[model samples]
Target: MESTQVHTLNLTSVLSVSKKIILTRYWHFVSLSILLFFPLSFSLINISSIIHLFTDDHSNNHKLLITYLLIVYILALCAIGAISYSTHHDFFGEPVKFFDSLKSLTFSFLPITSTAIIAHVIICLISLTFILLVGTILMLVHNLGFVVIDYNSVYFMWFLVIMGVILIAIVLYFYVEWSLAFVVVVVESKWGFAALMRSSYLVKGMRSVSLLVMLYFWGCGVLIVLICSTNMHAIVITTLGSFFFTMFLLRITAANTVLYNYCKALHGELELEVGEGFVHEYMNIPSEN
Candidate 1:
């Protein structure tokens, strides 16, 4: 929870980022609140099943499970956009109803979210390829007697482990660098890959700040995983874990949206489109039947 203080666009530290996450009166936006609450409820109802899916590796539906997870991830991104948009709107003095945010999300935001997800997936695949290539070369060099290093040595094993960590860190760096694409799409109404390019551009020169925020999210995720792993059978713990995880995710979304707006302001590109939500509402207003 954040103390009640007016926030500024100058995000110079993690404390500033935390303020963005904590200061939002997200509960005031009823529609967005309901959208967030659904995840908690769903988690509670399906906690046992979800636990089984991960803990019981004997389940043979790997393809189906992967497909389901992908769909869920995309939907979660879209939801994040909606929640963040609502938060951003409030910050810009244009507080909007949930329906307005939902309208924007369904009509425009989904494609942007999908594109960002696809771009991220492609990047991960590339990173994995690079890691594999390096490993293969190392193995080949050892196998062909071109190097004196033994494959089974502790030092060689540590070298491979260190290389894997370095590769993961490189991937995480880009992940943070492009973290704001979803918010960029919702705020600027950017389409397809444009959102991604915009995110990269806005995040330029601020990768360190973005990385700090990313680390907080990573920490939250690690905490949730640890809690879930240890308390799988404790219903109360599981429920609270789901609730906190959902809140942590929403907080990250809020932080990203704030960071995006700040970057825009820094570059003199903070065009928030006042009443954009109102325009959505007008368009969504149905004729009397």
Candidate 2:
């Protein structure tokens, strides 16, 4: 009975276990590299966006925003891939090199990363379209310009607002569930939408925990940056703010990678080693420490 109880207690939630792994010195160095590399990468990527922002044509600002998003999204995927790949190396007690992780972005990683970014952009467009539809209906109703029946329009506006909130909530949940797709892409060498499908599969029954972990880290990072922005010097704020934000990203990536492994373990899928390529044959599942 005591042994059974011990076995049950050993199966702690992945978040709790992963928190320990992410904080270790081995992973911290990899995360630090990511934190340092991000700003330099962002500056290079932002050149075109800054040029667009300063252009005389304010009417094309929407197009500029889309262009900026495309640039940022592509760079963000590469950064994520680099960081997550490095963490995977350290997780398995392998010798981790920065360039090796960057090189690991080949195979299914880049394609899946591109696909995930495109999918996110699509989701944003769909959400924007819904918002526009709501605005259009409101406009048409107002143009009808009913005086006595204006109360009906007001009520309908409230309903639309509520619907907008609900739609946002649903999208948030969907995003959370699919958040680990990149990790799956790297680990399993899955291509394109297939990686997303694998991520959706692995995230089953874990959405609440995933959402909470993300919010906790991101909220803390935002709060720290906000405080620094208010009270610190510009240089201090820029340096320290970026540090905290990068740390948050690093930790989140690590935790999600750990979660991915745990889910694969649960499903009896073979675990990929740090330097191992994807193989079809299932190996015996190892006991988790």
Candidate 3:
């Protein structure tokens, strides 16, 4: 009987520890939930846009595309900036409410959005260079193959490009995980240039944790997109869903908080040092430690 009681106690403790870990990690779960909501909303909106494009006359449809694209870019830039700020605010354990996020983003997001645009430009340049180089080589290959009566390979080339794009996207997710938080830091600190460097320092030894956090959200995001795409015809019903998403749906705070906590744990185990003023200025609370 005593032995049986001991086993029950052990099982209880194990379950308790597991629950604690999940509760502590609940922030990431919330972030994933927020992320899932947005894409599902956007996918629905985009599908509606596409349905309209198909039904409308060519001129009107073309204008619609342009308008949608412009709105998407602006929204994307602003959203990126907002997320950057909000995520960092979450990082320092500061309360990152939805309205506060909106206000901070509305006021200061342009700078970070501009920074994001610059980064995107640099990415575009690199992509352009790669395309030019690769195109030249492919052209030469095709020209030489033409002598052997084999000039066309459009299908294979497109497939290769598609695969390369997917690969690059995966690599970029891993690369930008830390920098996502950098935007918020920059806005709050008024040290835009140094934000990336500071992010590097913060994430120095937490690459694996960052990668896992990203992968978790990525999986959730893809799943939500897939589910939403199935019933895309309903998107044309109303724009209310998309509006709700942009205004309130997206929340990456919890995942960021989880990552921060993970890093904090690592920081303790590894004895990594934090900046002395980090808690006072960025965190906005007395340091628990």
Candidate 4:
């Protein structure tokens, strides 16, 4: 029943804590990574192959793409669920076990999957809506004779570039807001829209930190993709890329779970505790909020 007070955490602190936790529970995450992330990494590393399949065989491409998406989606959910569960328990000074983390997934998998689907659908809808709105505005301007249709015009190109940047910003905004939805589903037992809402609420004061954390991991992912794509025929490069990608997946999930705890503590929703020896050094255990 003992608890430690949680304090505000920035991007550096969050990543630092995440790294420490992974180092502390190194084997548990490694096993989970091998079980779930290793296979997922193959799909990521061979993404160019899938694109080649698209050009070579249109009919079979659809089947392969669909099957691939399904398998990747399931594997991703499993990785997130197991990592989130283990990280949460470990964050609170509880014992963490790989098998127990896998078993905990039976209860969390459905909820986290539902939340992910809901978040994905919502993001897609938002994107479509933004595109439609932009199109409508462009059409209106065209009709009003404010701007003529000139694809090659520098002004028109700048306008398009501005719109694209705005769209990306909007999408990233929502992404950062709901980045913790799966963690919410796993830790709070909330699902779908409820989890999304909770994540948005929790991430309010910490959006910048979340965004930076996301961008760091995203940049690493992009780097891995570039290495794999450029060295498609190199088995060693692909394998190494997959291993680093798996490590990134584990770290990002752990970072998100740790951020979730910090958010909860910031909002006075949950009390958190680090393990012995590290608690006093890294966290402030206030008597009360």
The TM-score leader among the candidates is 4
Residue clash pairs of candidate 4: none
**C-alpha lDDT of all candidate models, in order:** 0.64, 0.61, 0.48, 0.83
Q: Could you report the Cα RMSD, in angstroms, for every candidate shown?
A: 8.8, 6.8, 9.7, 4.0
Which lDDT tens digits does candidate 3 get at residues 1-289? 1222222222223223323333544454245334434544575446655657655765455666666666656655555555545555444445466556656655665666555555566567766776777668768876877534233568776757785896587447535544434343444444344544445555655555455545555555455555555655575433444544433333333344334433443345212323422332222212121
Off by over 4 Å in 2: 1-16, 26-37, 40-73, 132-161, 231-233, 270-289
TM-score of candidate 2 against the unseen true structure: 0.69
- TM-score each candidate: 0.76, 0.69, 0.57, 0.89
lDDT of 2 by residue, 16-56 (tens): 54555555554544444454445533333243444556564
TM-score of candidate 1 to 2 decimals: 0.76
**lDDT for position 185 in model 4:** 90
Task: Please say which candidate is ahead in lDDT: 1 or 2.
Answer: 1
| Model 1 ranges off by over 4 Å | 1-24, 28-71, 271-289
C-alpha RMSD (angstroms) for model 3: 9.7
Best by lDDT: 4
